[model samples]
Target: MYSKNVPSGFPRGFLWGGATAANQVEGAWNIAGKGISTAEVVKRSTNRKDFTMNQITKQSLTAAINDSSTTTYPKRRGVDFYHHYKEDIKLFAEMGFKAYRLSIAWTRIFPNGDEAEPNEQGLLFYDHAFETCCKYGIEPVVTISHYEMPLGLTLKNNGWAARETINEYTKFTKVLFERYRGIVKYWLTFNEINAAVWGFNGTGALDDDLPNDQKMQLRYQALHHQFIASALAVLQCHKLDPEAKIGCMLARMQTYAKTPAPLDVRAAQLQDQLNLFFTDVQVRGEYPNYMNRYFYDNGIELKFAADDEEILAKGKVDYLSFSYYMSTVTADDNNITKATGNFALGEANPYLTSSEWGWQIDPVGLRIALNELWDRYQIPLFIVENGLGAVDELTPDRKIHDDYRIDYLRKHIIQMKEAIQDGVELIGYTTWGPIDLISASTSEMAKRYGFIYVDQDDEGRGSLTRIRKDSFYWFKKVIASNGREV
Candidate 1:
């Protein structure tokens, strides 16, 4: 879309690729010694607007676990990436991907999360996957724990709400670091760790009827335990693989003021601060002063271990990675047109267009997010996830023409280039799941967000074939030109 007159700002070796979580892409959830994950039992909603909560309760989870078929549980039958890794990675190589951001299924490594010995078959699976990625010259960027946690952990102590899961998680990370020491250098401790604020963090919190104050208390407490665990994992990664880099991931929610009113501006500022509170803790090695007042006013009390502060201070993340898809504006008014997208609520931004799912499209918001984060942290940033989820169609000739997806990404990449010129040290951009995988929130194949289209229905019926959309070649060109062609 840009002419040669606009100089490209993307850095050399700027890891260009795609991202996918284990739970969202990898099927075979209960095979080869892989245990059930918290993400496994939750069912998808028929309504596009409704989403799946982290429903890891005792009764519902038990019933869902007993059923072996993946017909209703669409996530259990992903795009079948587990069986198609070699093919998928080969396709990525064809597109000249420099990196592939993916996650390890915790259940596959530690069947019950507290197991002493690791699962060899599960370990072997990833070994082959990583070796294949390396063979194709793709750097493997792995998230130690994505949205899925071993359901066994949740059943035992309600997942991260208790202190025990932290140790189990660290043990899992130690296994990964020792096994894939030289192969995987870029690591993320958690996927969207800040999602814990809403209790839909996928950390295995029991999702059921609960009082508002109690739920918030439990969510904050669970998030604290995760902070401790992440710090511990950071320390372990450094100790084991001295050359490795460990980071914290957040689902960034960029906010804007709906009007120039002073209260509205302040509301936007406070919301953005609260959204970035996770980065302040992980990147700055301590909680911000603002959250103290938040916790006090909300009647939320956090219990910390004796050595928690020391661990956090000693093991700060080397980088900060985040997923930025959409942004919303906020106002101080009690009632207005509410914005709903990517699990955030605010005033609808009339200045931006909306995606098919009503996510307000604000390419400039990405530039704003990058500048704000870089100015605050001053460390390298990685955009691990960004894409549009839409209903794709396959033509009679077996071709998918998705120009809308191309336009969405093209605008965002341009904004990223602008941010780089503005002095944001960007590590790379990995659009979420280059191949179409089941949606994590809604678990629908119809909500496709990929350059490669998978022939799978929301009901888990199709050839499971992978076809490249027009955007696939467009992205290939963008990568080849290092964002100059876009």
Candidate 2:
């Protein structure tokens, strides 16, 4: 348990940073030898409407591919970060960022995932990007594949479901490792690798039209391929630059039993086990014993090469990083009310409040998640993404008063300090998005999560101006004081 009277601050040299994905932030999707990615095919909703997983069905995706209109696909014009990266990095520096978490759009490096040669233009863009980060003394934490893969891979190879895609991913990772070897030291093999299992839409590797059993089989197979690719990437990174710290990213979803009944407790435990399956493979380098019965019951048989287990055993991650937006509850009874979070659904906790998007707010859950992860993995943990996404209004005086956002962050930071005091080896905390960008689930700008506000809207109409909200200064002071002032 965590106590507030410990009278301590964050560890020395703790990384204070922000995170963003290329597909959500960097526009210029078709330029500089960049091929169309799966993200490019996701249509942006016109109204501020929430999207269900059915929105990206196979038929709709095919239509989006043939549409040839970038207007419908807002990810094609993601905040224009490709052209405005220097400006944006400058803003991050102004906020006194010690690190920046971003992704390398795989399509940008390899116009097609299985290409023989790399794109010089795309490589040079990241070269300049990393150099700029180094210029400001901000360490770059790069995710090799952050829900952005070349569309060609899915169409031709069925994404990671096909074993060949692993080779292609290895090629991509090698290019990144060799190119940014010395400049970037922190690497995340896959963003939310577990999303491939439950939230297949985010992985962009699943076709919604597939049969239920087939979908499950393909999803698990694809997850297996990613595990192998991640492991191989870890080995390659060490060989190229032994100092590089490569970690696996999981969408950590903490759950609680609705009642003290043994059935409810067992249900919640099973749900948590399913959620932790990805981390178990990546961090432990082997499948858990429980998975044997799971595979038998589901009739899911994963294909493996002769050396797959050996490869996995040798390529375990150096650390564990994850995103925690909310916690949930479960029960054997169906009467419990449900709530939504970052592509996850569970019973609502009556005691906790929710955000505009109906995501339950639980600052103490963050501390609980930290302790749980540390106790399980016994490795250094990184809070790579945690924030509150709400509607922000720019006042008449051109200032945004986001005291609510500040309060949300302050409470979470307090819990984070307590988690550290409780003996969790925490590396750092980077808020989901330091500047507003496209929402991953809804593709709307209105669902903003940033201390620095980007002037944009659902229809993609704004001056593309960047403004610092009240929380921005508050965060700056917190970082300056090393989490003492928060």
Candidate 3:
């Protein structure tokens, strides 16, 4: 079956590309028509015992976490993509990128988060950026809102907690759709919409470290708001230009188990319900039975406004896009592998090595995820983010030997090709952090994910130089051969 399923190559017009988010890549943190974002308040700490580093970490371990509320310091230049986009896009074009996936900063458009009018300066910045990509025959795929929301709106209205957030989000999307309708044909309403289940902090939820009843409330409320907003944005795109295609981007987290035990099986099922269920509603226009039952049993009823259901039905997305990184093993009581002293939550994989940041490497899991997403939605799938995050060292001669990243991408591409041959209607493959950006989860400079490396560090000091790694040339060959050469 595996041999018969291998594809000779991708379809002729299949898009080959890479992706990045505005907040992570486009530093200028508060410059050039950009407004303050929650990321602005978010800070990263190296020493776990530093009390001054509040928003990014709360523990006494020497690691970083996003504790944004108390971290008063601003984010340092996050790769400075805002000013260096021309040079970066040129490199992408040189690599033969057919499509480039990026997001528009909402704060840049509506500085204070929401306004009756958008800042022309903000719109003009993208106008040039997208037009530049078009000039080189690279189609720009835009995510209207990434992880960073306007700090003004989030802090004032509690972000997606209030219904007003839907209105605010609509305001931003309405203008973007109308303005960039022709130049940017592909659109994602939100980046990782289901990530709210993790929470408001960097983990995309309120408390990833510990769970509480109130966290569930916050999660549900935030999801409800985003669902409504996404539905409305889809409708807006269609109304503004019926030819436009809008998608809801999600984090397609692949969950597995240390062993095929009953509890491990149940744990995996629960995660599918928790993660994929959110996208199910947006793509299928209805919630799955397991998700509905869980919500009811947990006493977490989702409230929708009067026109919410109608809006959702009318504005159903044209496709589904997701980011697949690592796979996780789970078990009910963390007792699945007692003899090996391994726990359900996490343990070193005996069969596979991990990224420096600890995400499990499983290229085959990508193919499995592709099939699951396609089987469930029956809609086209666009891979919005997929890549290897590693520590890249720039030699004195300015050369980066990133064969590890090349290997990571090569294996993933092989699985993606296999998935396509299996009849999954995949649109494009965009490796996350195409040009190294700050890590969203760890908030570190060293955790890199890019074919083109950015010279920077965690302490916010570096030459801000860009150098193509070995993966850059390998990826170029992949794009040129359409998966046959690489």
On lDDT, the candidate that comes out on top is 1
Runs with alpha carbons beyond 4 Å of true place in candidate 1: 1-8, 52-58, 207-209
**Model 3 worst lDDT window (10 residues):** 337-346
C-alpha-based local distance difference test score of model 2: 0.87
Of models 1 and 2, which has the larger lDDT? Answer: 1
* Model 1 lDDT at residue 340: 67
Give the lDDT of residue 62 in candidate 2. 76
Would you estimate the TM-scores of all the predictions?
Answer: 0.97, 0.96, 0.89
Residue ranges of candidate 2 with Cα displaced over 4 Å: 1-7, 46-55, 199-203
Best by TM-score: 1
Q: How many clashes in candidate 1?
A: 1
Candidate 2, residue 455: Cα displacement in angstroms equals: 1.6
Report the backbone clash tally of model 2: 0
On TM-score, the stronger of 2 and 3 is: 2
Scanning candidate 1 in windows of ten residues, the lowest lDDT window is: 49-58
Model 3, 154-198: lDDT tens digits are 556767777887788888888898898787889998887765755
